[model samples]
Target: MTKAFIIPLLLWANSTYTQTSLNLKPGDTLTYSPRSDKPAWISIQSNEANMVVALFMDGKKVKEQDDSRGIKSVERLYYIPEKGRKYELKIWAKSYIERSKPVKISINESKNVDILKGQFSPDQLVEDLHTFRAIREQVNSGLYVYRSKKQIDSIYQQAETETRNSKTIFDFYKVIARLTGFEGSCHNYTDLPNHASYYLTQKSEYLPVTLKNIDGRLLQDSKGVAMPLGAEILSINGVPAKEMISRLAQYYFSDGFSMPYRETIGFDRGMLDKFYIEFGTHKNYVISYRWNGKVDEVSLPGISLENFKKLQESRHSLSFDKKLMSEKYSLTKEGEGIYRLSLRGFDFAVGQEDPAYKKFSVFLDQMIDTLEKEKIENLIVDLRGNTGGTGAVYEKVFTYLTQRPFRDSHYAYTKFNEVPMGEKLVITPLFLSNGVQDKNGLNAYLKQLYPKAVQGKYYWADDKNPSILPNEKTFKGQLYLLVDQRVASAASHLASLIKSYTNAVVIGKETVGGYYEHNGHLPLVYELPNTGIQTGFSIVHVIQDARNLPDQKKGQGIVPHIEVHQTDQEFLEQTDVYLKKVFEYMKK
Candidate 1:
């Protein structure tokens, strides 16, 4: 799914559309234009099941939806319109259709709507839950990656039982999120509906303190009125710190059996958001903590979202500025023969011709040129907070690091060639514009790309798993890889490649991404019927080209050869403990 699909789903609400009754032939097209600049929900229902709807803004194709599954008669689309911009909705029958039918089209202009307080009956919630389950079972290739079928069924039963008591959309969201997280794929997640998220931002009751988890202990990273920095939190609002962490951890998604990822998310700024969801709004907090050598209690008032942001900026020790966050890669000369390349992220464009990809390619080329000219003997690749991006970008980076030929993955597979639940799936506009408009088009494209792929079975993506030679100017110096819990997806893939094929010394905490295999590649997103909640999961199950090291275990993330974590003093002083370890290792 695209950013437009995900962001608008959380920021907009549904409304009644102007009903229009129409009778058209198979080849005829019906165009509906909105009168205002507000977001609109367009719904088209046909007596037959071959209606294709396309959205055009400023004469450019924005999105296209064609639901010919004959399952649901209505096809819905949501789009936010710009002022003075011309938008048109084009509806037509598929070219293969021989006959035409009566179609009912409606456009609902979205207004200021509050879905936070919206309540659903037991039946409505259950229906949505069933729909969610059906979609996952049919489309998610990694549904049983970590858990057995029996275990998944039992979890679903538990979710259904909990759903019966859910009144608000937020309540159901928790049940769904917990279930999604339990699936153990980092890519799987169910986001709260837009209005509910909006509701959170408007409320003034939120935990003000930022936290850091060092070796399972939650410590205050920010200075509060009564608690000092590095104070160990024993409890909050009478709930034991251990119990609270464990309970809130379930709401976060991580790769199979990886605890560090959940721990990282639990103690970061996400703590405030997850706390509000799990424990509800709080005006004040009774916090018990250990500062220095004594344990004490503190009563602190909750801060608003605005105030929390300000507090994080002023007091949080690990808060990053906008420039730091935006940086993709940086290289610094550490010593006479040592250089540290910090790859913050891998979210560059995949195409070689694209400006982003070209820039990244040039940066790597220059780094290699410098290494050759300066006679740099040691290179440290620091991937501390990288959270993954384009697989091709990582592959490109690996080419410059390794002298031997490498394949991106050992194997990659998906459940289906054609998209399952096409009627309910929210596809990106890029897919549609590239001729994948409906089930048949998707099937044809998949078959063309993966000629050996079969329907209703695991189709190995061999075409995408081709081996390639190393770059001419591959780095030949001694290498060291620095990774932490925040390293995931493509970033972790790079770590896995380096650890597997090269003699690079691996250090720092275990990565959040799987070491051997993970559910990745194409993501399929669906919106729940009742709550309008969007749930997404990656369809491709990727088995990476990794060596079976004793430390790298199954159903776990990339465990470094030398596992190191931040100490209390280092955390408080905002020191790079991993780099300190690297320098310590160099002495030997």
Candidate 2:
């Protein structure tokens, strides 16, 4: 029952945001006892002010903010089910903008008593089957037509395969996870049997000479050219890339937002070791890809997974700018007190109880106070990296900043028609339940509409039908927000809300969250490893951010009010040129 030691570490979506070490901006750090038992609660001290932290068991609630605690004191409480491998701890933070981090948390379940206490039986299996079936129906009914059929067939096969394989549901679920790997949907995962931990790393066996879509029709004889972020499908030793693709897809499925098939097609091999490429189950050839988008084909023996990873890391160092990260992260005190704060994203390693969030919170509060204090003529509020965080925290921020009756503040939205609750699809009145002085708040009603939705629980980056704004007494001074394509989901909601303000100006790129509206999801199937099947799709289209009436076309995402974007060259320069221009305007 015992083996080696493991620790819970988080792999933050660091690529989403820029890392800036500045005065007005903040950083992060953490505090936790090393020898804690399972279900251990870790204390976090974040640098950002006015943030709220909460924990979840695979997206279900564990903890949240309280009056006694200032900000993010109780960061996350992990349930360490005794899996032999490891599961990355998923922790989310809601600040001026929302962010998330995946950390490694060790589950100590080797104790004989612990094992005795944790073991599930045939009765437990029945319960799991019942739970999974009910959830599967919910997920299946709401899919976007085509995705629905696939989900049904996938689940049916996984269940059947489990019985035939004489495998536990746990082992079966792992196989189901393999098929739906390209989805890039987060929190959509399966567990291993007997709480045996599965390693997230590519530490297991692997191939080299990664490749993307090859028309076995054309490249059957030749090894495919390499590009950035490409996948290794086959080995020089004639192993199929199916397993490899499945594993790689599993990693991205945590993404959830993008279309799976298209992503697979556009993949590039950024860095891969010199291994042979066995394209399409047959002919083998050696391959090399240069930094300048050039391909080199050769006849090589083989490469190890470790060598592939090292080569990829080396290539990443070459492709990703080093100096820019250093320069961009450097902060300069813009002015007295009112320092310009512009960083990319929220970093948990920066710590749970980070000062950056606190400083930003204080900065926001003081900004309002300063407007009243110095009788300042104008104010420029830039919200670029703000993803939606603890919805309650935003409630406080919005209440203080935009005070008035939310009678006129109604957000428009459309619901997942499958639920067929009613024709009236609206979100503004719902989220802004108790805005008016005379009313108690529509909070109770919204909760009833979607039972799973809770106040403190984190919503997706793009929650539909979010909180309503008070159109009355909005900031008259120039409130300019600079967005990029990165402005997504919750960020999109906030941007749209700000634009709805009487005098606010939204400047920057379009948002990445879907244009219509969709919610964060939980996978329905338990999965069986080795089988090419899975059940996945949204349970409900629960719209959080939508406009009046509806926009039926669901492919593209939302657009910005004052549209702006950097050229491909400008983007490569790693300059927020639009941010730069916005600053130029603020100077005036």
Candidate 3:
């Protein structure tokens, strides 16, 4: 949980701002009246290491920045100010600190230039890299789960070397992206600040064509492009297709060594933005592809972000039924004796009384009644593209599929008993409680759940793991599980349980989430002191309830019994390849 600090409301009269900078002590409020209706950049410099500065517009908190471990003297915040409008700036130390030094605050008209195109000094980039590594080491429980400490140190060294010569934030992002990928946790990632991301999306330089990774080849999946559908792309610009894919793959991290997940996830619907980030803004792209057994090259102009999205919906070949993709959960009859349960995600509320949970309960009850009435013999549980959500939700789903009792995990633990770097941690609305904010609420919450938890030791979370009986009306038929690279966390946990305890025919590629274990739950995100780039990783390391099966590999996602990839024909036709394979298996 984030350490929440209370912002005291003080009545301040609007005053015409004549000075460029203002001095502020703890609990002091300074109001500035902007002369023009334009965006403004605010920077605060503090001798006090743990001070937080909050900007309020029209009595609403607009932005907040804290001095992060004194990595930099000046902490920056951005907001759009209207003419003749009053904005208030307040500074205060965290709850634990009693005294703090005065801070210097300054505001200036934001430049019209895109912040994404802005450059940082080589020293600043390297310092931010070190800060990034420090934060990860302190908070990430799975930092060395897949890669050794030496391997991680070498990755950071290489990143430092690359960051030293970096010109722009995107350039620095590439270096950081590689390190994040090497970290080998899907939950870990680095991204530009919100303001910078907003400015980037406003540009019309994103690649127009959407591509899909099929059988290790980049194939055009969008219409209106010069290349035909399913055209095998050989290169973009001067970079070979293989090399480009390899570079872009580093921008995404998957659990363990799931190479397919890293290679394929980046090229999905949001490929345009990923393409723009890896390869800089381009007005046009020179793409070479092999069409109808002939190598052809074409120069295609880039489209606006809006137009690119339009094309994805209107012309994308792999677009599924709108209703199917939008719903959280649905059950439909696939054939005379088979039923398809499409679980796009497991994001339902955990509390039984909560509307979300109640709704899911009603849906499941209705689904079971229909299945029993129809005497369905074959059931396909589609867990494709489900990144995961509430743990209780998936556990509920598992009860219907399994005959034996089970538990969600063998155990789960975090690196620390209290919030690490509480001063630098970002405070969100979720952390707010009655008048007082405690950053150590996470530890307190955990202690409440597990009274035996001790400091400097792994809390055996499942020491009292009582066996949960299967649902009384559980399905007593042949079960087929459909999963892919996108299945993760709770979804993957469910898959592991089914594979370990029951007889189910699993289809599709290996899941990106680990089969036996994963570092998940209670993710912590922090911004780099210099670059302001946000990095997040999970803190809880979990040993899942999975058996030592021959097919299940260590430090890897749950491998499907029958691994299936989308064929060229399936890609072009937008066919359900995994479902087709299931039907094929049933015919035998």
Candidate 4:
């Protein structure tokens, strides 16, 4: 991890060629080239079996650098150019029976490269900035913020320097990681496919069965149709399941997921498009199953990459993902013709002033109007997917539903600062004042003071919450409020309010379970060792009715009145476990 020498030598190729020779196999040489301008990609093609290609340059092994060969697969590509200098190349076979000749290379050419582009998205930049602030706050709040303002000034200066060289969004992801304070969180975090249209694409081929947990060396499939999930894998086009896992591991591990850092956490959610395997070392090539082996060996002329992605999204025989939304979060007519609407995930691409926000507001209004027309029994507001937003347009929504004017009673609390904190913060309750003491005891105080409160516009206090029309009723029918571990922040707030006031049945597992008041903060915070990440700070705390909720660990998440658990059998059975529970409760 040398700082000055962190810059890699770019390898460029002018042309492309598929190897007639099996490069990755044992005893075979695997090598390819890329264009000079972007010198990065390498093609590993060799006749050798289990070809182990290791890149050793200038007496140093470049293992951390991203290259071909799976996560564990050794690659023969160098980030630094060996233009004219002597460099070593090692390509060996697994069994040690086959290997490749060490072809010595020279590095003489040097391209006069100028400033590299700066890359980072607005949210990513804010996240990076927030990181530095957290570290500074923890290390010595006085020295970092109040004393000299050392960290802040330094970060602003560095960001000014880097943005001049960032290129694509990927580059943006990289640049911010390299910024201040991000340390562990900013390592190799790529905000790929965060956009509505852009899906994060893994480099592995999508296998037939959806994988749950790959314990030890055994591979388990959720689609129960297969007895021993691992046993059905059969072959990599008749090659072997174990070999396929090796190829797949490159993708799973390289993702740097499961990292404690906010930025480098793993991405098991996004799946790869497709896989191309040649069994028996290129003697036979077969495309893996896309829809649970429903249609194998895809019958098409020339397999293209676009078609490959389509096959993956087609959920034919897959189990439900825990974080996904299905029937539970839907809008439907009830006995009285009232609407039972369950919302999840911040799927709405709404902005405060944006038309999308207005559009969403209108959608809510329409739902209410429809319920009125249908003369429905009552509205069941299910917020299973509300990961949270500005609550985005909750204000606009409440107006249409509530019958009378209500003042926002929820207080906007915070530890006075220059930034606006988003309501989703882990805060320390400093101004419990006399209110917290009124709670049942110390347990309630811990939940309130240490970190529980939002200083945002998400919730409307009793006064702020509009009153129902004198002629109207409290969602007259049974309001089944569905929630889960995924319900968090604003969603949790809604769940809390629904549970406490309306006495709504909080169904599903515990919520991702967080609630508080906060607003956007941090003009920026930067990570120290981590790159391409910017951070920020904010001030505000959301302290809803804290006495009632459970402690911040096991019971912290909003629990369901009627509980439903995700079963191991569901993966194999492909049953809507949670939904089945929801519907069952609805029927009862």
Candidate 5:
């Protein structure tokens, strides 16, 4: 149980979006007994940058929010105090980073309220530190692959000691975050609980300039008050930029020791806050940067979080047209006898709302029909930025592409014969029956496909390998697949299929999410009671049998056949370097 003490204080708060504050400290659970005669709305904001709040009505959890970083509210509650009805509000730190950080919850109540604030003493800090140990235990047991047992053990052992001794909770969180990244899984890692995004934009502080990693160098991509654009960063504070990047990269990993993926996110604005969480938050930064082959120093002031968020949003507004986030799939004619098929995602609901949008199966069948009818000789399938969806959605893609029966294998672990109720909440409801639309028709089929659970962890084989034959409308043409590091999950699964089975040449950078193994499909979120630290873990281990596929890496992404890398200049100019390479290869 968490060590907590409640202060008996009755305060009146106006029913405004932002007003009234409740003191909440780490390792404490505040039970607020709110009294109202009628239905009311209460706005809640926590000082914990990364915290989880569960709303309970008389001890039953009614609502829960994880990865909460902004001011949130519990709306439309029926609380009749005259009828002896009561509502309890509980809040706690969700990660080691959130430990010791005091969060002020802003509550706007329709009626005058008596709020109970939970405060934790310094003595309770070690109880919160136990969260890190629990996290380490869970990760070590369930992760598909990690560093050698000794190495992982050593890292956790060091983190445990540091967590216990560290006075600042944020520093303790950084240790565990680094440990999580050491596993080298893109899907794994602990989010900084004290991130600035958790606070109100007006109250939060942010770095003055925007950063970008180009050609492996961290550079100023936008203009700052004192720094010019395209300035290469030499150092942050007193540490060399390269050294800082290496240190921070430990908190972010993308599938099997890929530094490029970390480099790409190194430019993200969120990195600014993450940096502060690891190091301490500062008001001014002395940056040593290089521009025009000459070293320069600049003192930049930090901007308000609201302003920085706007700046980041404005950057995306500039490149609204280039992104392929819309529509599940689209096919277009780029040239005579050549086609470009952009498969952005594999979701069933992606384009289904549009009256003109065809079903995914219909779209693929018609795409093949168009290719054959138009006598298309070359096809470029753009899988760039596709993070993947239901495996059943992409299974249809392989059904039409395969020339013979295809065999795929996976190993999974579960606590029961079917998915547990709590774990099922983690899966998309649309994918509950493997994307089958009809409940009556798919009930028996789903029951058969659910993997049987065993007592510990054990390997299992896929029993169903459907015989797939290429359709008559299949286009016998030169196939090219466009991929990038953003290609993940089910998308990576699709890439592995084409590269292994078909004559298609994969182009662009290596995909994210492992080519041979991934741990997902069902993720469970657990909150440590003592500290309120929360984390999500994949309950199942998915390993695709790639023995038939040659030149596969164990815990790495799918390597492209014809590598097409982009230059820093090309990226700044918004040039399609990879597409150009594809066209050039076709010409050859």
Candidate 6:
């Protein structure tokens, strides 16, 4: 791939109009000004094999385009240009760039401009309404997290009522996203469908600053000089910031709410941008914020989309706490007889070229060897930021920690034995077919259940067999598990297993993807036929015993034995607040 570079040029100069062009490579940027007051059309044609283009208007990303149908992606934005206002067009190859592609970009006064106007036809709006209803039906039937069908139906109906009154495609996107959130299932989300994605990209605008819900307050996270660091947000464009986030949160989780999950997904740049577009695309926002216990208001101009994206990247790079969290999966010596092992994720494709998976295997082997060689006493398994993948990814780690038997999950159940697959509804299969062959009796039982698999009926594993495999080098030490809300899916299952089968004290926030009712194994994505809004749901429902709490309620998060919360001071200082608590406990 070629290195990044930017070449800027002035296109034309006249009393009525002025234009600029930029030659962009991977990670490169270019800014241009619209010269005329009339409606302007910006067009892009790139020669790169797979290029993704991002369009920013008045400092906010309005649209993005990607390669399509054997053609390098071509996209055009049409909008009434504000004279002397600047717009940005940035391009890069999605994977890698062998060489800089020749891109032809131009801004011209449009002759026929009504097509750029933002309004869907009555027929198109009707089609989108039907699509939204279908999406609601699919969620009501397939999602395994809900306790009852009535609960799911109620949430879908709310979305249905909103969809019926929706006029534009952007309005439909907002409503569908809200319903997806109501499902309260992580990994299930909605986005602009392919047919309508291009039309809205050129017109949408978003709130410039990125935010995080910290201490129940919306705080601006961008390190830009214009905004105060960790400033408490009060309102945006006259609407209360909390009210705005509450509305946006509807598109994420309905129940089983995780703060980390909500802030990360709900308050992201794209969703915030879509929210503003769905409401109204405004150039400048009047924002109210609080700093040092005093309230203040400012008219903040929206920053470029690329600028906001770059800010997030910079924050991760600069944060010391995040640096300590990264190693993918590694074992490190903190002090004599004490070691900290960080396992970032468990999502592995088993036999794929997964570095995290390969490293986890190697790390476990080395950890055992080290434990055998040294008189290690405390081993801290860090699962703080793990969002989960495959549950069996850490089977070897389990072997070194246990001497007796270990049950991964109590049992798994599904609403349907045979569920239809694909958008085309091809390859319907029984739920038992999704089971992995780790246990002997359970594997055999699953195969037998395959023949008796029935549709639209709940099915479950009959066998509650425990896996018994102790590694030769079993470490007899005090095991400590470090976890937080980010620990989810299979990672959450592993947390439950550690508490259940091994002698370990879990320390941190209550886990979001809990033992009794978190969904996994195999998930399916479905696209609404008419509007093309995509949503996904998990088929298998797994129940595992909470390690320390024997009587934990269904869908309840695994409460930590020693709860720890990050103070704002600790966060800014990049302190290991959770680990510090563990250190103090060991000394005691």
TM-score quality measure for candidate 4:
0.44
For every model shown, what is its TM-score relative to the native structure?
0.79, 0.43, 0.79, 0.44, 0.72, 0.70
RMSD of every candidate to native, in Å, equals: 7.9, 15.5, 6.9, 18.9, 9.7, 9.9
> In candidate 4, residue 586 scores what lDDT?
65
Over 259-281, each residue of candidate 3 has an lDDT whose tens digit, in order, gives: 77888877774464566677766
Stretches of model 5 off by over 4 angstroms after superposition: 1-106, 109-144, 192-195, 199-205, 223-226, 316-322, 348-358, 407-410, 414-455, 458-472, 545-551
Q: Which stretches of candidate 4 lie over 4 Å from their true place?
A: 1-210, 213-330, 334-339, 345-353, 396-409, 413-416, 419-474, 515-525, 529-539, 545-555, 586-588
Q: Which stretches of candidate 3 lie over 4 Å from their true place?
A: 1-117, 195-205, 313-315, 321-323, 429-438, 449-455, 460-466
Off by over 4 Å in 6: 1-145, 194-206, 254-260, 268-281, 316-325, 348-359, 415-418, 421-468, 545-551
Backbone clash numbers for all candidates listed: 3, 91, 0, 112, 6, 10
Worst 10 residues of 2 by lDDT: 421-430
Q: Tell me, by lDDT, which candidate is best.
A: 1
Show the lowest summed lDDT stretch of 10 residues, model 1: 1-10
Worst 10 residues of 4 by lDDT: 253-262
Compared with the true structure, the alpha-carbon lDDT of candidate 6 equals 0.58
Tens digit of per-residue lDDT, candidate 1, span 24-110: 543357666655466655555543333567989898998898533221234556678777788877776542211123334333445
lDDT of each: 0.74, 0.35, 0.72, 0.38, 0.59, 0.58
Residue 417, model 5: lDDT of 31
| Predicted structure 4: lDDT | 0.38
Q: Per-residue error at 145 for model 4, in Å?
A: 19
Error of 2 at 89 (Å): 17
Q: Candidate 5 lDDT, tens digit per residue, 1-588?
A: 565444344454443333346666545676655544466655444533344556776678887755332222122232344365456766554432212346665545564333222233434545554654554454333443646778877877776676666654455556666766777666664543223333223333466766666556777766444676667888877888777677666656676665555656645634545665555545777899987789989887777755765666555223622465676688889888899888887755443343333466678888888988888888888888787776666666766666755544445543333332221121222233344322232334435544454565433435643444655556567888898877877778878878777778889888776787776554444343433334455544666644455656676688888877655556567677778888889888
Give the per-residue Cα lDDT of candidate 3 at 135: 85
For candidate 6, report its TM-score. Answer: 0.70
